[model samples]
Target: MSGILAGKRILVTGVITDASIGFHVAKFAQEEGAEVILTGFGRLSLVERIAKRLPKPAPVIELDVQNQEQLDGLEGKIREYLGDDASLDGVVHSIAFGPQGAFNFLEASWEDVSTAVHVSAYSLKSLTTACLPLMEERGGSVVGLTFDAQFAWPKYDWMGVAKAALESTSRYLARDLGAKNIRCNLIAAGPVKSMAARSIPGFEELADVWKHRAPIGWELSDAEPAARGVVGLLSDWFPKTTGEIVHVDGGVHMMGA
Candidate 1:
């Protein structure tokens, strides 16, 4: 059968490795017929190596979300990559980083905590807004990856605060962009054993909690479903949905743990 996202042009970030959730999103988006673009931090060669694995190879663009100059150049960069006439159909804000300090709350420094907020939270606003010019031409969806914003988790610490801020930021973006028929939403995903998750001090402990607490049961290292949720939201199906937080945590957020 055919797919839902044919011919759509989408940009996805935060793919550090094949284990990263962003990788699955890019893989599936291409399978569903979308033209995928990728943004990478640190090393371009690493991203270039991984790019060969996607359904259709994508160009690796350098875009450290925290870099103002890089952010400012995004629209032009994208246009240059996709040609001037091809406007963006969707954007994935699957970007975040916090260092070790952000995971220990009481032990975390202001510098580290602030870094968490800037990279994990504020960068979403930066990225989405940078892509706004392309999206505005015909309306589009902005999907961000998030964790539960309702409560703090043990060892999740400052990253939790950043997530809360991210959720609020997404809603604000949705509100501002609604007039243009653009949508902004988040996928509050379960813990997956990605490179980013490995940075957390007690990720295994948190994963154990999910394995037990989630009614449907959650996996420590599964990202496929989360990727599917992102692709679906990016598609044309959820036209009226904006400022929404869709929990893809295997029903864990619903029950008391």
Candidate 2:
């Protein structure tokens, strides 16, 4: 328990597979001496299985950011494992989704767009608020994952817009929550070939950008760099940093065309 996250408790969401950034974040958090709890959306069993691969045993909690009931009951569920007065030192939001229609921006409907925004963007707010009570007294870090939404990418479409909203939401959360000593920040990572990437239409075309532009080079398979960024933000090392977007994309976000 001598690591940077020693004695801390962190809640990680959207862990569907070992290849996911969320999974790695959970793994690293535990390795750094933090107690990690995970939340799964649709496939609880799959998430539970993945959680077993972490450095230490982590309890899996069922959570759907869009589910009002689940959001309202999140603290209680977390308490079930950590006890009635359980507190969280950090929360990782690696959740995002968009219907197939969203990939075709022009043809996408409000239903598709709404679902994309709701789950990908709004959930940041909802999830953070849901965890507020646990963090209010002592304050903690809220780290979320984001693809660089500053530019449009092939097939990213509406999901890009949702990420934009997510980025903005983090800023406002930081602005409001800073008074409570809580920090909200995001890691804008490069693409990885995880289960979530497979869902994106023409994902390679998107990843291809990193291939040519990332000044330091990019690895579509390596998630450790990004996971480390999350752990860094969660630690006391960033005591004065909030509402920031740290790019862990091989410096791709900075390369100019």
Candidate 3:
């Protein structure tokens, strides 16, 4: 192992299956020499089972970002898992979800829209703050995933908006945490066929576009490429970079017509 992340302790969220981008990140992080912990979103048992499949067994803890109590007690829980002296070297926020109503543009109510933003966007701040105590002293990196929200992707209405907000939130976090030496960035990935993607109604809008436009082309079934980008950002290679969106969309973002 090159051990690019040797001696680093990282937190990875949103792993429901081996196909999840978080799964890939955790897998690669381990292969590259990092001790990782995972957050279970309302299903610790399922996540625990999945964690066993990783290169090394990682501890999975319950964490629903919307729950204030869980967020508040995260540090102590993590410390208990990683040890008192364990200071996180990086965090991967692959968490994002939108209620069904929010998938429709005009049909989405403020209630639905807010839920999307809160889960997909606001959680970035919430999750990061939960780890701030462990991160602030030694400083680390925070990396999240996003489906490019620049345009109105069909059936991806409110969720798209939430991602844009997520992008902005990373920038603000980078600005504020820079002095503390904490870097914040995001990976704007192409359409991936993860468990989350299967839940979305019209995810094909992206797959269709990628097939017709992407210069380098994209493989919806393959998340390792995008996953690699996130792990790289979590490593020491991107020490001086923050607030940037690393696009892993196979040149699709660069094409207009």
Candidate 4:
């Protein structure tokens, strides 16, 4: 297939390593002819190294979503890199984080839960609005990565709460941005062996359930399909679709048996 995203300029956040889901999105976005820029939190060297793995090495910008200054200055920073006249075609919000103990509800503290909510959930709103200046008037798509948190999962704990909030945030964004022709959606992906997942206690057990329940079967290591789903939503193909949750979970979210 020819590139569905040709001439599109996209900003992708949360690229920490080659194993990152955002990394795959950036790589594939370039392959599909989109001009892609990346954002990293704290670890600039790590994101720089990961940027080398993309089809074309993309410039990495510093964006700690939790930091108000970073959020406030994102549009100008991105414009400086992409050129002052450039407008964004899409945004991939792959940023999320949770304290280790938050993965264990029984051991999680209020502070930790609030941190997770702020980082994993609220950051989507922050980052999206920060980049809205680049997307405003022109219209574009916003794709966020999420796990299925509508239902509970072992070891997912407060991160699950964060994901639920993330899902809700996407919908509200979709509603408000719809009149402007900006689409907001999310990919409810299955568990994959990413750096963040490794931090969760007993992630292996959660992986095992998908193997048995997913109709199309699920692999913990594969990220390509998930990346494709994200790009599709960001493409013109889903023009009328907003506030929707697209599942890239191998049909697991739909099955009851």
Candidate 5:
């Protein structure tokens, strides 16, 4: 493990398939010379199966972001797995979810919306803090994924609002975690054909936003570019940057139209 991230240990969450942002992040992180550990959300068997597909074998740990017990025990669980020598230099939080009800803005309920906010937005804070003990000692980075939540997008209702909350939460994490030299940032990626995207009721409509508006153009199938941005943030290159949202959406965020 000796490359840009040589000697770094990173924890990656939310990897379901090869098409996932987390999958690409972890894949590239390993290629860049980081030892990776993954937190499989709920589906340990499936996540473990997917882990074997990485460049190297990554040990899978169980983590349920909303489950306080899992959050409470993650540090020890990781410690026991890696022995006392385990210390993380970076973490990738690519977790997000919104119930079916939350997709239609007009029909969404508070319960569904809260679930989105909790899982998609609040988990950033939860995952960051849960991993801090391992990170703070050496000073590291926390990178998460988000979509631009600045405006309402079709079929992206409560999750969009949740991303707005996620955006705010990252800034606050940067403010508080700065003292410990732990940088937390996000990548607001454009739509890609991941499992998460496919799950959206009107995913194609959302994809069109990028197709027509992004000044640099866009790709709905390639997630590598965005994944690269996440890996870059996790590296030491952006040492002074935190609480910032780096747009990897083909310059879409910069356009007014």
Candidate 6:
């Protein structure tokens, strides 16, 4: 109860497994004395089960970033637990997805590309805006997860483009929301062997890049570094930092080929 996040309320989305960075972010947030709420898409029951694994019990809300109905109703659903006048100090967006077709940049159709951008890129804006009413008055942090979009990785394809869009979205959100005292930023995390990673075609090829380029070395199984970065941004420590991408990639982003 006496940690950096003491008395803070945070909403974390896309926690599907204990191995995920999102799950660790939720865990660390609570350990740092924050009240954490979670949102999951598709398998609500599974997500609920995963939530129980946290040090403290967190309420799970169903959210599909692509579902406008869900987006529109998000704040109300959050209020169901936190009360009618609830406010949030932080919101973690760890959500992203792409259809298999999106893995092939050359052959990917508009539908595939659109879905990738909508869920991975556009959702950042939608999710943050949905939480604006809760955060605007007092201001808070909006932290999103991203892969370094500076260069194309093997098999990443359109997802890389989507990340670029996501990075841009954060900057614009920071620009527009700064007047309201809100801060929007992202953590460009290294590859982890998460459920989301498994879904990516040729994920190891992407992971392999870290093996060679990470100057300080990288652990594909570890997510705590990135999670710690997220909690750091959420804390009051970075009040002046916004529209920034903190790299938690063991220096991989800086290494050149």
Residue-level lDDT tens digits of model 3 in 88-125: 99999999989899988888999989988999999999
What's the C-alpha lDDT at position 195 in model 4? 91
Report the C-alpha lDDT of model 4 over 15-127, residue by residue, as the tens digit: 87788889999988999989999998887998998898888889988988889998899889888988899899999999888888788788889989999999999988998
Residue lDDT tens for model 1, 124-152: 88998899888887999999999997897
RMSD of each: 1.2, 0.7, 1.0, 1.2, 1.1, 0.7
Alpha-carbon local distance difference test for all models: 0.90, 0.94, 0.92, 0.90, 0.91, 0.96
Candidate 2 residue-wise lDDT, 1-257, digit = tens: 78999999999998999999999999889889999999998889999888888887689999989899999999999999999989999999999999999999899999999999999999999999999999999999999999999998888999999999999999999999999999999999999999999999999999999888998998999988999999999999999999999999998888876
On lDDT, the leading prediction is 6
Cα lDDT, model 6, residue 8: 97
Instruction: Enumerate clash totals for all models, in the order shown.
Output: 0, 0, 0, 0, 0, 0
Candidate 5 per-residue C-alpha lDDT over 150-186 given as tens digits, one digit per residue, 9 for 90 to 100: 8888889899999999999999999999999999999
Task: Say which prediction, candidate 1 or candidate 3, comes out ahead on lDDT.
Answer: 3
The residue-level lDDT of candidate 5 at 102 comes to 94
Let me know the TM-score candidate 4 reaches against the reference structure: 0.97
Give the worst 10-residue stretch by lDDT in candidate 3: 198-207
TM-score, cand. 3 = 0.98
* Model 6 lDDT per residue over 110-207, tens place: 99999999999999999999999999889999999999999988999999999999999999999999999999999999999999999999999989
Alpha-carbon shift of residue 16 in model 2 (angstroms): 0.3
Q: Compute each candidate's TM-score over C-alphas.
A: 0.97, 0.99, 0.98, 0.97, 0.97, 0.99
